[model samples]
Target chain A: MRRNRALLILLAVAFGAAFLKAGSFPGVAAFVPAPATHIAATTAHVESRFASSKLHTQVHAASAIELKDGTVRAFWFSGSREGAADVTIHSAVFDPQLGRWGKETVVASRESTQHGLHRYVSKVGNPVPARTADGRLWLYYVTVSLGGWAGSSITAISSDDEGLSWSAPRRLITSPFANISTLVKGAPFLYADGTLGLPVYHESFSKFAELLRLDRHGTVIDKQRLAAGGQGSLQPVLLVQDAQRATVLTRYSGSEAPRRARTMSTQDGGQHWSAPVASALPNPDAALSAVVLADGRWLAALNNQQAGRDSLSLMLSADQGASWRVVQVLEDQRGQAAACEPRIDAALRQSDLAVAHAAPEVYAGYRDSARVKVQSGGACNFEFSYPYLIQTRAGDFHLLYTWNRVFIKHLHFDTAWIEQRLREAAP
Target chain B: MMAYTDLTGLAGVAFALGVMLSRLPLISRFAVARSWLVAGIMALALLPVSDLSLAGYVRGVSGDLSVTSLLLLGLTLLSRAHPQRQGLLLLVAGAALALYPAAMGLGSFDPYRLGYGGYAALAALLLLALWHWVRGNGLIVLGLALAVSAWALGGYESANLWDYLIDPWVAIHALFALGRAGLAALKRRGGAR
Candidate 1:
């Protein structure tokens, strides 16, 4: 009789503890902050071009941010080749008045990352620099410890004085198994409470996009997968309509039948997402950038082709991505201003075959000509891809993209330019 | 934060050492043999041979173990009990053999997804917890305690539920323990011939 009484007491305590735990904490609700209400100086069409990276090395996948001091800082990885040991993250500050980019600063290296992680690092790539709500700049990049890109980890470094100095690098615990295979590409958005929502992809065995919700200190708080299982999609670009509604445009990765850019939406601020459906924009398995403009419209820069990066264009969507139309042909392959030297033809099976087979002299010519084009401000026709867009407080859109895999071309324009282009393309 | 994460794995190594030392005749003489064994392991984590402690090296091999694994060790050590259930051991073995290879890119259908808002894994864990309770084992209670504490304190670096429940080291150790027990049982049955 005493033992039975003890057992009843134990059960009561267990049930009581569970009840307390289940009732104490509340769920995360969608909290959307109000948009900025300030007006810019003007809405006229104004564009300025500059090459942020001056290195002749293989440069790609650049991200940028406009500082509080009115300086535009751009960052990308440059090395002898992609995933090379000598690969380092390079940064440059753009002087808006002088209309030129400063000398590149070698910010992060493989040695520094290995030292911080206390593990052997094989290579590094894809540095994404962004300004937090508190005015500090945080840079996140990928580092491979073993195997291919599937064995990669994300590391972070913060800068208080813009891109001048940085804090010690620390690895973000993104995965359970040695933290491998997770890669970041899209620009990180934020919640109303200063939480960062970074879009990451898994490429180990599955190609899908996941939104990692992190605290202000970069600790991952939660994760929600945007795409799962089937139709291979990755590198999602998030566009926020408000606090409760957002859309992710993912680059379709189906090689056999490359179709339009796939899209998914979240009605509850990224907590839940709809199944990814193909949108009305073609993709060639390349990185793209999308943003929700201040005027309640959507803008995206993507390779509008079925299977090649030979063409890139700007598309506008006014009906919340339900329909889209090409506002401007940013780069055209059939035009006379197409990239000439590294010509992709019928014999070239791989899309990056031209880059693989191009001679040093050919790459040098493309680099030198791209530098000249940035200065002279003419048509940009050389393999301009991997575009990242950011709108500043002055209502100007800053675009940073890879130019022929040798330079990071910075293009600053306004919404008026997009409006004019849409008018010209209309019937 | 990284140092804290590295040191948390010492709990796993310490428990493993304590379990081994408890089997020795000389060490088991003291009434507090298990406590002394755990204390010695804790000393190894704190003692600096030159500059780094032994905890650093052990953590490198056994990444960051789950809180559930650590709590299970504590429960066993405190109660001086061992639950020998073939069903639970087989479940752990199946998870180890299945997840380790797939995570290393062996096959498709990543079980890692089951950690991120996947319902099937949570359902299975619930069923397992119910089974443990019905069998009068303390593992379910300990698992619940660890899961609650980790969730409240944001214990592990990963936000995944699987990372909070199982890690590679825990899975492999469980498999090895089960394999050793099976071999010993086979020898007693004269199955080796």
Candidate 2:
């Protein structure tokens, strides 16, 4: 009996020690590397546009790509509110030289998706378009049939005429269980062999990121879960370092305070991934975009503030992603010089909301209240979030994000502009 | 387009149905009938009926039961010979209680997350299987050994280790069986008094 008692006590100690060792979190510095010395020219020519119709009730999850003709085409979903049946995918094109956005047009509607898919689409969200190596534009968007966002499934449509027209939509077979709960957000990574790596996430039964490896024909051939079993990470944005290596930054979704973004990397292509680790950067639980610049510098546009979407900052990293420094404050609740400019023109023949049949008094009241708040040093928490960044062949950075949830704002800048901002901010 | 992983789960369900029917005294009279019935159910589950496959129907109802639940069903069916019924029920009950609450986010720690090659849960399961082996309960030990091997060979759709260990179905069933056992024990004590 005494021998058995001793064995039990020893086993208890061993189990306790094992539990303690399992609970420790991985350190961030081990995953983050050292900084590099030089970077690309930071000067930039800045341009902003309200790509969506200013009269729309709400707009979000905007994505863009530069066509072969050098025209910047962007798309986002808009309606009375998100998840509304009447919501439709709205798109617009910007001429870089003219610096003006054309009229927004309805590209993909709920009825059109239903006709193409042969199933009922309750609503649509997160439309991401990527131009393949052969100049074919592949647009992937999310459709919900049964439940909330967790019931989302991705559908693919191609544009041969560069956003002018599209092919019939086909659902990507991502999951065997009715192909539900998979959604795409980050830009697709186009490989040399015409294969595409789309970063998607599952929100049903599990909140984890997955990399869907698709054939050139948009068929899902393989899938690898990123940060599998980790609860708080999703919407992974890929930043390629080489042909076989890349870094994925995921948005943390858990209810933990002081939310920070999650990070993972792939070395042997997308077959295997390092376990996700918390990054040093603070996340306000909002979507952010990252891109590897021509000179190998990393650029990210994110809500730098810890707990609010009111401030969006463009940040640059020299040595991979080991460290990040704020390059420019794109928008902040405190103020942007552009925000102070008069919103209502002197010739007030009509208001932007008038086209939507919205109450002008209510619209004007909200607008006046916002203006008063800004002028009184109490700027309303107008959100500038869900940034999507892409680099054109000319090496210019094109960024699109939501503006106060009212319009999809596009910002164009150059590497020289980023360098100048970093220089000025440096002591 | 149904994948092979989705179709294979029905084999366990068909086998379970056969085992349940064979346990009845009237059905057990014909020995060969049980094997034939199990084979027929498995064949039907693999085929399409009225445009909908049997696997599709089962997936619709169960939403893809975990590999663990399927293994548990197999062990329960086989354990009638070895008769470690109480031990197996308690083991399943413990796993279910440990996993479901954390999976539902009742705590900060999720054992479901551990289903993804989690070391602690794997170690605990290994120890439990070893205990069953020492007690000469080969059915459950065989189940655990096969589950681990299937996980290593990528037998299931999900790469998660927890998916092969415990799911909500097995957890709920185990908890109910344990509750019933507790009630029976209390009744026996009252009758003796």
Candidate 3:
């Protein structure tokens, strides 16, 4: 017994020495580069158009990034139905010189993704494109190998050229159990050392937000949970305040009252995070988007109501999200978007009368076109949800969202436009 | 690396399915010997099922089996060391209870994320294994040593160490065994009374 105790002590010493040698965190000589340059506002500019051409019957979860030549490329998933076997990842480019969005192109399909991953992929969705610090563009999206969305795994495909060609999809080995239920919806950001931080959520059973720190080669080095229990929040939109201080605004999925957006922050380059707390925005169980401008104000494009996506409001926070006030109603159809809402029944009848009076063929076409069924358990004629917000290097805010489940609507506005509106709504 | 992932997955599938196959009445009756039965199971594990082998399809559903799970399943099926298993099952069950709930984002701290950096969890596991070794638990020590070695080898596609250590299936198996052991102990106590 005495010799065994000594041997145990020796083993403890050996393991302790190895632990000290291995260290807690990597010796990442923190690179402190400014994230974005301050491009001045000009002429209160705002450009609005559709990012996705009317190609597939459904499109949602759009993400964008500024290219090297100052053009914008937006990415989203489209198919006859969400999670259908034919669902694919698609992208379109916005030319600043021409002031127009090009035709949408298929970036990845189910067949190509399965071929690259060497596994059977039922579907793919939520393509988020971001330019890494090394000038390579990486698109991270979710692919379901089995079951439903809860069986998701994130796959990354990169492009060396500016949104022209893509590499084969590679599945990120994230989970222990079959690598399932890890989904990506937020914009991936860069750390001081050029490492990438991808905000992802798990919906296997408990819903919670997590941040994954990846090396420059897209390998996950560390991961931190951004919420407590994580059952209440998901789809976190990341906003970096500085090199070390950053915040994440998550969509509330909890079953409690008030139904506000959840927020979690990190002060140590994501090594640790505070417990998530409810932000001052009414989430209504919808995905939202946010971006920090060069001038230090933050903008979130989200459905601000407590019930529906009939109105997407542009909310501004000057004090780094402690307080918020709606600047503009970007899309407010009131009760016009919902088929189940009793308030929209009168207008729905009038619209039906107008379509019916025009022609029988026109009424049939309108009825077919106006049919908007979302995976969120509702059929509505209009829904403005799944907004993804990003600010270009040229100081323009592009808010892209799912417009009625049929189009990815892009709302472009310059810093000048934001500044002019902020001045008008100044308290 | 992906080929290595596929190989590890195939092996895991084979052994996991091997345990199930050995229990079948036909195979058990035909092969009275366990070695022959296990060999036949390994041979049949390579049967193709579409894009993957039979084991590959099982891996497609259960993900890749952890190294510890693979080894434990192998040892219990191969070796006749039944005396050491009860302690190992209790240890695994206790660990699974600590790990699974916390890994699913039950709180602010996530134990699974430690698999990425791996220093802290590795030290903790090393000490646990050492304690078991001092207590003469050879099977538990062997399982931990094999899992850690496999993780260091990087033969599996997962970069995380937790994926090599324990999985949901192993945890569930340990829990079920522990329950059975407890129930039997209660029965014996009742019979004594």
Per-candidate TM-scores read 0.75, 0.61, 0.86
Pairs of residues clashing in candidate 1: A32-A243
Kindly report, for each predicted structure in the order presented, the TM-score of its chain A compared with the true chain A.
Answer: 0.83, 0.81, 0.85
Give the range where candidate 1 chain A is weakest over 10 consecutive residues by summed lDDT.
A344-353
RMSD for each of the candidates:
7.7, 11.1, 5.1
Q: Which of the predicted structures, 1 or 3, would earn the higher lDDT when compared with the native? A: 3
**A417: Cα error in model 1, Å:** 1.6
How much of the true A–B contact set does each candidate keep? 0.10, 0.00, 0.38
Off by over 4 Å in 2: A1-43, A334-379, B1-193
**Top TM-score model:** 3
lDDT of 2 at A42: 50
Clashing residue pairs for model 3:
A44-A417, A178-B63, A207-A230
Q: Write the per-residue lDDT of candidate 2 for residues A1-427, one digit (tens) a residue.
A: 4544444444445444433433432211111121232444554667565667555367889998888888889989888778989888888998887877888888888777765654456788899997665778989999887778887888788999998999987666455334467888898877656567789887877687777766566655455667664467888999877766779998888767678888988786555678888776678878889988766788999988678787789998888788999998887654434434253221111223232244777556545533443344544346678999988767777899987667677778887787788889998
Q: State residue A332's C-alpha deviation in candidate 1, in Å.
A: 3.5
Off by over 4 Å in 1: A1-26, A31-50, A131-135, A256-258, A333-382, B9-62, B67-88, B91-136, B139-156, B159-161, B172-193
DockQ of every predicted complex:
0.19, 0.12, 0.43
Candidate 1 DockQ, CA atoms: 0.19
